[model samples]
Target chain A: MFNWKLLKTIYLYDGTLNGLFTIAFDCYIFKSIPSNIIFEDNYISNFLDTAIYIKTDNEKSSRIWNGLYNNVSYDTLYNCYYAFLSCQKNKEINILKYILKAFIDGPKINTMLHIDYVLEVMKLRKNVLHESHRLKGLTRLSEINKNLFYASIHPDNNVIELLGHFFIKRFPLQNLILHDKNRNLLFLYNSQNPNNYEIISSPSNFNISNYSIEEIEFQNLWKTFFKNISIKERTNPRLQMQYMPKKYWQNLTELK
Target chain B: MDIQEKLEILSDAAKYDASCSSSGSNRKNSSNGIGNGDISGICHSWGADGRCISLLKILMTNCCMYDCKYCINRRTNAVPRATFTPREIADLTIGFYKRNYIEGLFLSSAVIKSADYTTELMIQAITILRNEYNFHGYIHAKTIPGSSQELIDQLGKLVDRMSVNIELPSNDSLKLLAPDKSKLDIVKPMSYISNKLENNQRLLSTFSKKRNFSLSPVTKYQKEKFVPAGQTTQMIIGATPETDLKIIKLSESLYNTMKLKRVYYSAYVSINKDSCLPTLDKPPLLRENRLYQADWLLRFYGFHADELLEEKHPNFNTFLDPKCDWALRNIDKFPVEINKASYSMLLRVPGIGVISAKRIITARRSFSLNFENLKKLGVVLKRARYFITCNGKYFDKISSFNPSFINENLLMLEKRSTPSKNNYSQLSLFENSLPTKGDVIKCLTGNF
Candidate 1:
């Protein structure tokens, strides 16, 4: 019999969902527990512990995913997917433990909030969903040219991938690009291909300074309207900051 | 005047209306239009007052024909007046909509010339946006009281939501403060829009049922809706001598009789000084906040007006929230067992809201819940600990069930959370302490 409890090891992956799931597959095959799961780029050497790099495998990851689907509910599977996309610390290992526990306990593990791993995964999913929803409303698009519009956001989580479906369906006749400055990523949508959106790496020297001739005037009008609409008698800066935090003010037009 | 100056004067004048919501409409962009509506509503930004700026709330014109006592844009007030042509209004809305600065337009007017003429101008602007620009976004149009029923019907078909301000709560107050307007004028348009909306819903339901039974391809835009988001009304708080009980009773009737979507309460900021208006150092914001809490209880928490207030206790307690107050008044109903209580009973608890109650229902189905499980399920343990029991066991810290004991602890918690110097001042034997402007403002805005 394999003594899985005695063998504690560290795992490294290429920061992809398939790679993460491959680690889960290897753990169950070798009957060993991961002490930590670190991204390949962020990994540092520790001489006292054993570490192994897990390559991404398509068949093994899909097999593990199919197993989870048959055992757990769709909401549980999606929660794991969303939580994995979060930039939280030690999220990969936390998600791995959650999936392993789900396989043993079945779908009821989702409602077992008393379990620490289950609750952590649920919290991470909620955090990512909340930021994506807020950005949907807070994204301020500017007319970069006659046919193109642009918006820039610096969110705390990896949420830009979640906004494409909403914006594409809402603006089917317009071309727009949503840029995530912190992650150096771009979500580009064109009117010709309204049904599809493309994600690309943002160039470091992207020019955002060139605006259409009438853009400045409209921006000024928006700022004026924003200023005059607030009642002076009920100016609660604390409440305002609570709703739109100070960190998001850098990209908002009216706040600047 | 330039568009910049016109927008400034008009939006400033329209600021006191106090209705900024842009939700509850599910209109879609079916015809390759420029915009669509979200059913849950999206707030694009927060104002300095912490109000959601969901729409570009502006007026067609600030030129008024009536001299109401409490209005900033009354005939006699010497504020700058401006009017936007229909073309300018349409252009501004599309520009703002394309850039995502607003969800849509909130078009109101100040009875320029007459009600019919003002409604005509608003209809023209909306017509241009809907037909000419092919914009399908949310539009909330304020119906001018006493406008012709035909004009009201026309305006209703083009907008997502409509409202007519009651201005004052009581007939006597209306007669004294706004002599030119009457209660019948406001109610006539409100009932007209209400009946029209009901008929629209009936027609749409039958149409949908027929289409569902027969699977011929049916377009989504089969019928033109009449105020798809329904209608709402507003009344100025502290403008009249009506008690909170009277106001709440009126709101309950409006929700029942008129089938109104929302009833907004605006704290009367004393912008215009008149003998008919109550003289205040600032607006009664605490009273307004209390009224909103009571309003929520009426709408969502399955509460009646009389259950919250009585003739003797005609107002809400300034420090305690309405739900906590009600829970304490009927203490026998509480200390509800978490595992055995029904969903509605759980909602009656102090800290368990609709979401938490539903969560409890879901979480309890798998395993019997304990206090630790309850906290993880998003119940505010600080407040719910006093009212609920886990597995027939009360919280460990709560030694007594005396109402006064619980009240004292809750008050202490409230004070600790909102520690304000103005609310608790040290008195001196020899010197007199007058309220500074800052203290007065804090007291008015309900910071404590």
Candidate 2:
């Protein structure tokens, strides 16, 4: 009578907010929880005997997002987007499970920390927010050209967009580009229109070594300041490495 | 001297000042200015010693007339001397700031000729940065101890924070080590700045329209022109014979009476071999860390200095943090119910930090929390389990309600909890080249 395989088909899609939302929209229409949901890049051939590729539909995804805003709390919808940005495996399925639970449990589900999935979303959001906050201090801008600053970062999470608020607020009149080398994305902020920031695909090769004369001089001064500030008696490399991890020293002006 | 050489000596000399923070001020940039002083200061980088490099911390000059024996730049020392003109200081700050190199300027100086002259030079440096350069960045300038009332008054209006180093713990220590500096010279400026800040707030609330922060004679009744982020001071510990009781009491008094924002405790850094000072192998950094923790208790937690240490227990327990040590002595306060305890009570419990206590209060409003929920709320259950309960169920099996019993377990836990100073995780100079996606995923989750 009943076939378990038919109902348990898992779906994988291209990794984007639109792609995840489309899958959620399908699950909502079907009124059934799939076996799993994941990104297409992470899809592994499994014995479940079914794999569906869902093309990203902008209209369908927008409908799902609007439906979420109308039904669930705005925080839950926002948290879903941020959680998807996490590079963690199972993050997509986790968000899907949260969405499915929210659809069944009602709008107040976001406030319930005792629920495991809701707590996981909160944890992942904190990780992303912490990295974004740390980068505000760690990012070192080098003036590559006349009045154009270039900074490169290889953050664990995709936090290029999140760093826009801090740099823009601090340098509203300066041209800045924050290039995320790992993810091949660039956040460009033009001084003329400081209100908006555009994200674009980064070129395959970008040179960070070419710097203006003033920038090279500033880097030297910064390096001098960095070298002299430490006390000779207290040489705790462990303590130094504990706070400013070694992995982040690659593009740091003082470290380089 | 070249700018690089000047920067090296001045920052090296200024390293001992220990007030590198750029927080507590929210000065916005002028619509046409180059920068804004953030309310929550940002650290641009960490130095080799791992201390934060928030501001471009530097001395105006490293040549001093008064030979304070603890100082490296005292009159008797054989060291290279350098000084930056006010214009050079101003230009360097703005140049480095535009390239995203620093938060702002933390300008201090040795007594070049006199306290008044040094203070005036510092004021001129800040004035140039603020007016000529049109820079609106954070400025933390050191107020020379015995500067004139006019110079001090003019100085406060131009900077975000001002500090006068209370170099020693007691008047006796002041007399013994640094004969050139006096207690009144250090304290009078602190009191003046504090009173001015208080009076400024009172006047601001009382007379909103008559606010004139211009030159003193512009308005009949001068409005309060003061340091917006407030004033802080520092004292050298282990250099003097004063007990921890004296240091903590001084900090508590400074906090309550002078209304000082922060009192930095500098352990005796033995840079000079003066016959008047005792020789130490190293700076007492551990004791300094303990004092900072105790200071946090005084400021944030509802604990007084006397409560943490009495006449019999004059010093903190070196093995345990000040809070946990206090908890063990006051064993009657243990086993606090997580659901029923007040915020203050919850904060008193070890391993439940301010964030977790607030989380508990927020989460408790929804439902009665269990142990698992407490862990999810970021409570370090390994340490908190012995002290807290959920619905009258203790997560860990309890021994007798004995002080020594709990203290024994805590001492063992303390040894295990702290990341070993020698064996912390290391990142070699170039161990990681390019992380794959799986490694990126782990790192994103805070595992890598």
Candidate 3:
């Protein structure tokens, strides 16, 4: 039998999802078959006799990404991207590599079964679905001074695209911002200001206390109304906890 | 009284009616009004108890001419009462709406002076909100039982929904408890509104036929336009000794015949010290919640009341929920093969809710699913473990398990702790029966 050490290869790149995806694309395009795979910063086995490190190339990565979009269906690319974002262990990368390898082999290979990869993709789909539902209930909008509506959210998944369907159709005229604090992602859709954003390490330190007195009064009235409407006879904390979990209570306006 | 004082008294009085949902209506803004009742609807805020507060749940007046023993605003109660003029209530609703404080108005009233008088006052408030203030937001008005048909017909056009409370399940209990209210009086107004809505739908359909291609303006305005959200009724549970079986049967008939959108079950809270009612220390909220779950099974899960509960077992088991209890009773239906079982069969398993059932169906369409796949789909196999099988093989703990033993074990696992507060404590009307400070903690967390 061939030596296992000669078959193994190790690749190092930026820890971000995009960077990892680029390496995966290069491995498929260049047909580099490795017995084992590990991330850049992770510890390696001392028993291995050989390990080849490949630096990620931006030009090759772009060409591969373009080929994925043009040659394969959009759904294929979406599934690959989602599987990458799931953040499963190193075994997941192997499964994803297998799926990409099958795709690159031929069109008939697309029908082949990769049970582990499909399950990983389903888990990622569930995360996206949950974040979308939570955003619908958790997004709290406040009127800013310039007649625009703004809201902030800290979600576990990158759900910026999911929130667009709800806010754009409902409030067509108003400008809005859906800030994901956990991921440091901002999705800004304003007719006056062209749609774009940059990742910030932390939310802006702009103080809301200095806003107009009218907004303050409105918040007070809403809190008072929320307090008065809850009937003591019908209090069910168990059910309440299920619908609005404690983890999200910190950001909800009505909860405070 | 000035508007503010009247608002305080009326709103405080109307706070107890728990039918504040403003969903399922699709009314839009018209040329004559300034507001629109949104289709997806609006949720103003959630209460401390976590119930959605969609409307300003309030009464026109707490002053009453009838003595309903279960009602806090009965005629003989020595509580301060106030009434809001149509203009005052309308202005308050507008002020609240403009400030994003409420979705709309949920206007109710105890019978003040007479049924006609109360109904007329409610009509005046809704009409002013529509014609004068140009407010087109949601309005859920309560139809007084003995009100005239003309008044009911008039109010139906201006509001989104109407409800006539069928407080007791049976006519005999209604006569004994609420002497002023009668079954005939309640059913009469409901029937009138039902006929009017049907006629409006027919008239609109016929007018559209005459117009050939486009919908006529009159047809568009009048087409099933009254109470487009339909109607709902509330029944007080545990007040008149009606069994869960009988209550559920009544709910099914109401849904089948009357076409009611919802039948709310309010657990009886002893708000009054009348000799005719029981003196329960706390409301049967858990029972009410169980009934709602059973109701969901009836409507969505394709179950009849008789199928779930029988005359011998009239009341639901307080320990286990209705679905779990049903599953235990029908143990032969267990060990459903995940890969081959249909959607309905999958739903019968304990811990498999509507969402999971649908997901299983969809996921299996692409490829055969096993136990591992079911777990990934979010099926709670902890409860469903004994019910489902994978590839014709039973899993651990489920294989060769006796049905009776499993049923007994489930019953024991579901038992709740008994309430520490004497459940038979005498109710005091003026003094707050609700616990205070440390006592409150015991009241909330103590076993019931």
Candidate 4:
């Protein structure tokens, strides 16, 4: 007979949601108890049970990821990642474990609405969706050159991947680079050429001189235009600060 | 007068007019013009004050024949008057557009000669921008009441947007203050534009059926469409003895009856010391902001003016935002279960905005949301705490708290004193510390 306390073993894995799912799958398949579990890299465990480092296999991870994608809605995959990115607490792991178990049980799992964990995951996903939409309107781009549109965003979440769909659709013909300087990532889309992107840990030094004289002239012209429009009679510094916060102005070319 | 001096005087005189928004129209560059209205335009620069400076928002002339009590450029005032010729004004617009100095021109005028004459000059300036200069950008023209319907119709086709200021809410107030203006004259031009737009739309839709071939690529009906961005009117708040409820109701009627794109409320700043008007120490800016918030609720939040401020509670609570005030009044609707509530129900909560409400709706489709998860989703629990519950579990509440008590508590919380600066010596360290002559020039011209 298994002692419930002794049988319970805490599983720790990489902080990624995929790593969490693999740990959950191993515990379930082997009939081993998950006493108190956490993302392996986050905190040191106090449990005396045996520690196992469950490696994240690309094939198995892709199989789980792709299975969720093909069987479930894009929203489900998005929510799972959103909940994963939240870095909330151990509950997030349990939620992910429930999702994996349902997926392992086959396509029928998508129909169930009784699970509270699924709802919480969807909430996190909705937040990421809202942020992506806001970025479309609020992402103020500066003209670096005639062909290049440069914008730097310091988003609270990893929304760099999400913004690409909007930029691609809006400025289809223009060559642009949307740099997530916080994440050190770039999405380069050139109109005359096919679209291709790469994750660079350290991008080469940028030179402002590479911009055309016309582009530089237009930038100055735009700045001049912005300066002239403010009405002195209705100057409300309080309202101005509210709309265009001081922290955002640091990156805005017009503010400079 | 030379164009430069005339421009300076006219632009300075036009400064008092607060309707400078250049959004809504999505006109693009055609074969006829060098400019494109697709871009957000030059007035994108916001000042230290909340006003957006996009257009060279100036009048064609400030030499008015009428003596409106609320007007700074009224005939009685001893301010220098100037008028810009159509050619000079047209040249200024094109030059400014080329330099990216302004998005376009907001050409308003005082009753310089006659209503017809002033309207003619404004039309002439816009015609040059459209036909001669081939500049296709955002132009917001003011329709002078009593101008010919033909002139109004002609001008409507050329400009992107137009406005007819209702200056005062009631006709009685109009007679008391701006005696020269009449409600019929104001409503007449708006009716003409609305009819023209309706007629143009009907003509375009019918043309597709009339022709044996597919829809015409270039229809005359499209060019004749009146004010593509529609009309907006301004009302002077706190100028007359009208209550806040009266003003909001007027705005609602203007939106519903007039089908206005926007109704700008210019807080009465006491620019002119006329015996008829109130002598306020400062402009009721906070009140204006509250009115704007209420206006936003009316437009976006499916709220009526009466719901926010009733006949008894005519004035909005100065301390709390309009939404919070509304929520406090309806305390019986409090502690709405987040998981079970509808999208509209979630939106009614004080702390939850449109975005957060939408998130709650979509998220609850899959899971029952709790308090901690709601906070993570960026819901303002401080204000919403009294209103919403997570899975039927209440977090915070003063059980016996009445609306007045909540109002007082919220008012105390809202009392934020702007950090006082001690010394003029620290001024140099900050950017835009003092408005220099250069800063004024840049603010005026969109050139820094």
Give the interface-residue alpha carbon RMSD of model 1.
1.3
Candidate 3's error at B365, in angstroms? 2.9
Determine the C-alpha RMSD for candidate 1 after optimal superposition of all C-alphas. 5.3
Write the candidate numbers in order of decreasing DockQ: 1, 2, 3, 4
**In DockQ terms, which candidate is top?**
1
Which residue runs of candidate 3 sit more than 4 Å off their true CA positions? A1-152, A158-203, A251-255, B1-11, B26-46, B83-105, B113-139, B150-158, B192-212, B215-224, B332-335, B416-448
Per-residue alpha-carbon lDDT of model 4 for B1-448, expressed as tens digits? Answer: 6555566677667766678887877675653355556334334446655776677777888899999999979999999888888887887776555433456789999997799999998998899888987777789999998899899888988998899989898989999998888889999998777777667667777776667665653455556567887889898888898889999998998888877888898888777887899998778887888999999888878888989998888998877899998888787787688988888888888878898898777657766778777776667787777666676777755554355766666665575443225522444655856788987998998632
DockQ of 4: 0.15
| lDDT of candidate model 2 versus the reference | 0.83
Clashes of 1: 0
Tell me the lDDT of model 1 at B318.
84
Q: How much is the lDDT of residue A61 in candidate 4?
A: 66
**Candidate 4, TM-score vs. the true structure?**
0.66
Best by lDDT: 1
lDDT of 3 at B282: 88
C-alpha positional error of residue A191 in candidate 3 after TM-score superposition, expressed in Å: 9.1
User: Model 1, A1-256: lDDT tens per residue?
Assistant: 2256534678889998889988888877766668899998998888998888889999989977888887777887888889987999799988888877777778888887767788889999999988887887788889999969999999989888887767776777879999999989999998987667898989998659888988899999999999999999999999999988889898889989
Off by over 4 Å in 4: A1-234, A245-256, B1-6, B31-43, B98-101, B197-213, B216-224, B396-405, B416-448
Cα lDDT tens digits, model 3, A1-256, are: 1121223555555555456556667666565655555566674546654555556667766765666667765555656555554435564354445446445553333333325554556567556666565566457666665545556676666666566545554444446666666666566667454344334344565224344455555555555556656667778787667666777776666677
Q: What is the TM-score of chain B alone in each candidate?
A: 0.92, 0.89, 0.85, 0.85
Predicted candidate 2 versus true structure: per-residue lDDT over A1-256, tens digit per residue: 1122225677889989899888877877776556777777877787855888889999889987887788877888888877877778777767876876776776777667787777888888888877877788888888989989898998998888878767787778789999999989999999888678999998898657688998888888888888999888878888888878888899788888
